[model samples]
Every structure is written in structure tokens, then in C-alpha cells.
Target: MCEANAYLIEGDDKNLIMEAVDTIEPDGDNLLICNIFGEQKVVKASIHSLSLVDHKIYLKG
Candidate 1:
């Protein structure tokens, strides 16, 4: 199974915005993420550095 999570660092706080996710992308000031339930989430990108691994976005501090 392919399980994933979205983690972001904002200022001095690190947060886990979601779990069991699928994909993520950079959209303007936010990161667009697709959850395991096929739901779309738009979160602020100011918190962390977004990295693309094997075409998947991994948000890191």
C-alpha cells in the first residue's frame, strides 16, 4: 500500500495537516494536496519547503 502524509513548517511550528494522502502540488501561496479519500486540500506554503519525490510532493521544514 502507498501511504503518505503532509507535513509543513510554518514560522517556528511544524504541523501535520493530513494523513493517508495521495498527492501534493504547489499552487501560488498554498500547497494543493489530494487526500486518501480523493479530497482536495489547499494549505499555506509559507510553513515549509515542498519537495518532489518520485513525482510526489513531500513538505519539509
Candidate 2:
């Protein structure tokens, strides 16, 4: 329930990358995201901002 949805931010657009992301781990120059359903994704991006109230995690690539 504390998990947050992940987004990739580009200029004025925000793209949803993953939902219900349970964990985010650093992988060299990339990030490893794991969802509640066991789905995983590796993205070459950096953390931009976090909206705890909205349960959102934004990243910049």
C-alpha cells in the first residue's frame, strides 16, 4: 500500500513506466524497479522528484 507508481518525465510530458512499484534499486548507471506483481524493469534514468501524497515517482532520462 506504500508502493508508488513510476513515471518518466520529458519536458512537459510525464509517461507512466511502472505501477505499484515496491522497490527501486541502483544498478550502475541505471535503476531497477520491481512492482508488487513481481514485474521488473531497468531504466537508464535518474530520480527527478517524488510526490508522496500522489504516490508518484518521477525520473528523468
TM-scores across all candidates? Answer: 0.59, 0.93
**In model 2, what lDDT does residue 38 have?**
100
- Give the alpha-carbon lDDT of every model: 0.64, 0.94
Scored by TM-score, the top model is: 2
For model 2, the local distance difference test gives: 0.94
For residues 6-59, could you state the per-residue lDDT of candidate 2 as single tens digits? 999989999999999998988999999999999999999988899978999999
Worst 10 residues of 2 by lDDT: 45-54
Off by over 4 Å in 1: 46-61
Clashing pairs in model 1, backbone N/Cα/C closer than 3 A: 9-47, 10-47
For model 2, the stretches where C-alpha displacement exceeds 4 angstroms are none
Query: How do the residues 1-61 of candidate 1 rate in per-residue lDDT, one tens digit apiece?
Result: 4756666756676567777777767789777888878888887663344433422234653
* Weakest lDDT window of 10 consecutive positions for candidate 1: 47-56
